[model samples]
Target: MAKPKAKLETLQDKEILTSELAAIVGKTPQWIRQLTRDKVLNQVSRGKYNLGEAVQAYCEHVSGGKEEEQKPRLIDFKTRYEKTKAEKAELELERIKGNLHAAADVEWLLSDMILTIKTRLLGVPSRVSTECENESADVVESVVRREIETALSAMAKYTPDQIGGDVSHGGPEDS
Candidate 1:
């Protein structure tokens, strides 16, 4: 006479230790414990798991089962936030180094420069009119040329120290 073996029932009928489950899942026992703590895996008893349920839960977790964020995802979010913060700090440093200027300051400077040029040019006709009137054609031409040259000379020189700008901060480059 031979002894008969009892047939296994459901997959949950088999229970395994954490270390054994960790080996089957190809992860460290510590990582298995972490998954247990996160409710991604269940325990059949202390240090043990139902094989079938553990496998099913692990599959759903890996498949991104619409659960809350995991540790890895939280790490990724932190990395992106730090990267953005660092970029903003770099921009602020560049601005402090005077490598950048505000739009309002630039606009005001341009308007002032244009007004100065306009004033100098408009004054030329008035200043030279009397001298030009009583002179010969060549004399009148030279007087007008000298007045225009004076205005152009002023236009060629620019310094940030004038009015609202600070020389130490430097000025905007030519557009």
Candidate 2:
């Protein structure tokens, strides 16, 4: 006995049910219905579908195939400019603070030297006595002068410009 040949029918513009689509896709009928309900697959007609459109929609959903939306980045030109400006201001403030500390140290050293010389001169009893003794006065004056000269020379070697300002302040007019 011989078997009969299968007939080939031309497809028409029509709709199919979930069971028929599941047969074409080789999935369970219930899974096809779920996909339709989730809108991953859309119905072209009631209880029917287009095979090509269904496959396209399923591929798009599974392949991370959404159109990319452009978003603005958080870091822009204005933000960078403001950050750089802040860093520069902080550096400048540090420099000014350093200069102020240096000036204070210079003033402190000058004051300490002046006080030491004054104390030494007062220790000479004859110089502080009621009688104006010429010899004791000369000795005190000579010692004070030598000490002031040494202090000024040391200052000039370390900070010439500052010492020059002090020297220019108390002097006769230069010819």
Model 1, C-alpha of 31: deviation from truth (Å): 19
Candidate 2, residues 45-128, lDDT tens digits: the string is: 777887677767766755544545563323444577899999988877865665323444455556645665566555544333
- Tens-digit per-residue lDDT, 113-146, candidate 1: 6777889888988888876887798987888788
Per-candidate Cα lDDT values, in order, are 0.77, 0.61
Q: Which stretches of candidate 2 lie over 4 Å from their true place?
A: 1-14, 70-175
Candidate 1: give its CA RMSD in angstroms: 8.1
lDDT of 1 at 119: 95
Give the distance in Å from residue 35's predicted Cα in candidate 1 to where it truly belongs: 13
List runs of model 1 lying over 4 Å from the truth. Answer: 1-81, 160-175
Cα error of candidate 1 at position 109, Å: 0.9
User: Candidate 1: deviation at residue 120, Å?
Assistant: 1.1
